[model samples]
Target chain A: MRAAIFRGAFAIQVEQIPDAALLEPTDAVVQITHACICGTDLWPYRGQGPYQPGWQIGHEWMGIVQDIGSEVRTIKRGDRVIASYDFCDGTCEFCLQGLDSACVQGGLWGFGHEGGQAEAIRACFADATLVVVPPEVEGDEALLKAILPLTDVMAAGHHAAVSANVRAGGRVAVIGDGAVGLCATLAARRLGAEQIIVLGHQPQRLALARQFGATDIITSNGDEAVQQALEMTQGGAQAVLECVGAKETIQMAVTLSRPGGTVGFVGAPHGQEVPLGHMFSSNIGLRGGLAPARAYLPELLAEVLAGRLDPSSVLDRTVSLAEVAAGYAAMDQRQAIKVMVRP
Target chain B: MRAAIFRGAFAIQVEQIPDAALLEPTDAVVQITHACICGTDLWPYRGQGPYQPGWQIGHEWMGIVQDIGSEVRTIKRGDRVIASYDFCDGTCEFCLQGLDSACVQGGLWGFGHEGGQAEAIRACFADATLVVVPPEVEGDEALLKAILPLTDVMAAGHHAAVSANVRAGGRVAVIGDGAVGLCATLAARRLGAEQIIVLGHQPQRLALARQFGATDIITSNGDEAVQQALEMTQGGAQAVLECVGAKETIQMAVTLSRPGGTVGFVGAPHGQEVPLGHMFSSNIGLRGGLAPARAYLPELLAEVLAGRLDPSSVLDRTVSLAEVAAGYAAMDQRQAIKVMVRP
Candidate 1:
């Protein structure tokens, strides 16, 4: 089997690795048909965070369950499925509360487990960790592409909306123009937010934001963006979705929220610090974190399958397993919103 | 008229001042019958935050309506009423959303306006800023004491519970055993939280917490309290009400919240810093701030009138206007949980 391995900063290589196999009865081998490079992948790709030299490197994929261990009951061979970015048993106290990311016995992918950007990968806690794809739509290329993001970004976007308590007829402001941010715009719309203001720096992405139900867009950065958002929303939005987790972005998210409003952030924090003073004086709230993708996958999948959601547009480029390095470079350089990997 | 004046650090003096009179058509004057020394008042007394010397002090009180401006409609002369700590018009966008503290035209007491500790106060936005006392209950000393906290602490505590989303059968933990923390315990019990854990440093306050419906009490401080709360909760609380706004207490609140749970804080932050890294990784949420006491006063008042709530016990000591300086010292030294002031 071949997998995308992190060699060093700006260096990724698809090399032959031992085939993924069932090491436990609760595990199943998924033959990856689709995978993607995430904004989070850029963290390690740019050497921004600690990453082992030779670790597996993908956590978003959907594939056919090629094999399952004897004890796996809910899923069997040949079944199509998509595993959440993080795996959970769905029975732990955390998982029961829909906080799958913090499941007591769960863990993230590409750490000790097989990477998703490979020919095949071992999925533990098969029944709870994997959401089976509908049999009728299994091989539809466009449909599969649309469903792919449900594994992470789409669910995360929904998490931001849910955490922020976006409601019908309410106003919302979304910070960031990344794939997750775009998805959040769509999610906010689905949640019935009447006004969706998207703040971003990219012209093309901002245009896409409009298509994804953003009623307004601000192309400025930093303080300028906050000013524009606050002015447009008349004081500030009722709910602000922070899809970018940088310090400035988080601060802007808080600043653009109305007094007594909430900021729901899902961007993986690097140097984010919540402005407690501002939040305290304004009665604003801060919520959201690593989204429980597993908990939201099914609902988002239904929306995709029903043709109401189409986040595949976020995947603007594609690459083969051997060219996964270029895929990372494209995303790192902002040349592509997201790069889908066909293994 | 006479009022409590802030002379300097560790200095409070009663001084003769101009009688309270309406400055705006929307204002009404109230003759103070009862007032209270708040934990917040200690800030200026201890010289912690910015405070103007010779400025009036105190913001929690209930009294008979002495006079009303031409435009004042809802409240009239001789009607007993309680004013929220902050005055608002109750018609602003923020106020309509139950955020009276952030009212567009609202302002805190004791800045330019006469403080509650004065013999009389000019209550602005009379129709909205004051909750009229039921005629039948007027002049009832015990009932008035029970209802006085509704002017601030009780309503603020209910705000914590409300902000934290305390629900029936939910597990809750309250940080701080001050008047507000005790009231939060009562609010949590009213909200139907099954397990109410009160964390504080004082045994007497903890005892009061139990009387207010705290099912468990932890007197430990800092990391030890977090550990005990985690162990006792089997993980962490589903809802945590942060009544103390210090940095260490804020961190403890975050550390003791279950993943996906929320910490509703009402403590005026001194040097509070929310640990975003821990919150992000654990999926914990932070909310609450200067509570909208006016929004919650009516509901809490009704509870008191029905014999279902009584928070007056928190006022263990009482002082006349001339002894208000000593009252501040007593609370500062933790000699009294809360001190009542009669003008």
Candidate 2:
């Protein structure tokens, strides 16, 4: 088997690795059909190395179940399925409470577990970790591409909306024009937000955000951006989805919220500290964290099947497993919004 | 007329002050029949003075309308009414959004405005700041006492519960046993929480909490309290009410919440900062601020009128206008839970 390995800053290598096999009775082996290079992948590549040298990388993936261990119950070999970023024991108390992100036995892909950007990967707790693709959509490439994002970004976007308590006929502001932010815009629309304002620096991404249901865009940054958003919303938005994890962006998201409004933040924190005093005095709320992708993937996949959401456009480039390094470079260099890796 | 003045630490004086008159066209003067010393009042008495020398004090009160300015429409002389701690123009964007605490034209009593612990208070934005008492219950001394807590403590507790999103059959933990925390326990019960845990140190206050519907009480403090609460609730509470605003208590409130749960905090923040990293990782949320008393007063007042809520027990002691200084002393020494002031 072959996998993409994180080989220090600005370096990735596709190399032969031991084949994935059933590591536990509850595990299943999956042959990757499609995987993705996430914006998060660029973090280690940019020298903020949280991963050790030669670490397995990549998380978002869809595949065909190649084999199942004796204890695997809900899924079988040859099933078409998608895996969320984190694998969890579906029966954990937290999982039952709809907080799969907080599952006691859960761990993220590629950090300490099998990386999804490989020819094959072994997944534990198969019954609770994989969402089977409906048979009708299995053979449709475009539909599958649209559904692929549900494994991570799209579900994350939905998490932001849900966290912010976005409602029909309510106003929303999404900060960031990345894949997650665009998907958040789509999620806000799907959840029936009447007015969506997307604030981002990238013109191209902002355009896509408009297509995703953003009613307005603020191209400005910092104080100017906050001022514009506050004025446009007549104070601020009822719900603000924070898709960028930087401290400034987090503060901006908080600033963009109306009194009694909520900021649903799915951005992975990077020196981000919540301004409690400001939020407290203004009656603003903060919610959302790492998306419970496994918990939300099924519903979002249903939406894709029903033809209400298509996020395939987020993947602007595709590569083979061997070219995964180039895919990472393209994303880091802003040459691609998101890169799909096919094996 | 006599008003309580903050003369500095451990000192309060009932001095003859200018009679409260219509300070604005939107103002209404209410002769104070009842006023109360809040736990917050003891902050300055203990030397954490946000108020300067001679600042008029106290904020919770209900009385007959003494007079109304030309612009005061909804209230007039002789009408019975209760004023929220803060005066807000109800027509502001924030006020209309049910965040009266964030109203653009709002200010708290006793800070820069006319204090309630006076013979009369000239409430600005009269139509918005005061809730008229129902004629039938207006003259009932016991019922009025029950309703008076609604002006501040009870409404604040309800705000905490509502902010925490306490739902029917949900499990809750209240992290205080003061007037506000006891009121919060009552609010949780009113909201239909099936399992309510009150964590406090004082046995008497805990007993009061039980009467207000606390199913369990943890008399321990610090780590032991957190451990007991976690074990008792089989993890943690779905909604944690933080009525004490110290740094440690705030952290404890966050620690006590179940994953994906919320901490509704109404404590006046005193050097408190949110633990954002822990909260984000656990999908925990923090909400609530200064209670939007004006917004919740009517609903809670109705609850009182319906014989559903009685927070009068929170007012364990009372004092006359001249003895307001003694009331402050008793509260500072924890000799009284709350003190009612009469002029």
Predicted structure 2: clash tally: 0
Q: DockQ numbers for every candidate?
A: 0.67, 0.55
Docking class of 1: medium
Clashing pairs in 2: none
DockQ of 1: 0.67
Mark the 10 consecutive residues where model 2 chain B has the least summed lDDT.
Answer: B269-278
C-alpha lDDT of all candidate models, in order: 0.91, 0.90
lDDT string, candidate 2, A262-284, tens digits: 99999986673667677778888
What C-alpha lDDT, on a 0 to 100 scale, does residue A288 get in candidate 1?
A: 91
Candidate 1: residue B257 lDDT (0-100): 93
Best DockQ goes to which candidate? 1
**Candidate 2 chain A — worst ten consecutive residues by lDDT sum?**
A269-278
- lDDT of candidate 2 over B36-125, digit per residue (tens): 999988888888857888899888998989899999889978989998988899998789878898989898899867899999988889
Looking at model 1, residue A109 earns an lDDT score of: 88
TM-scores of chain A in all candidate models: 0.98, 0.98
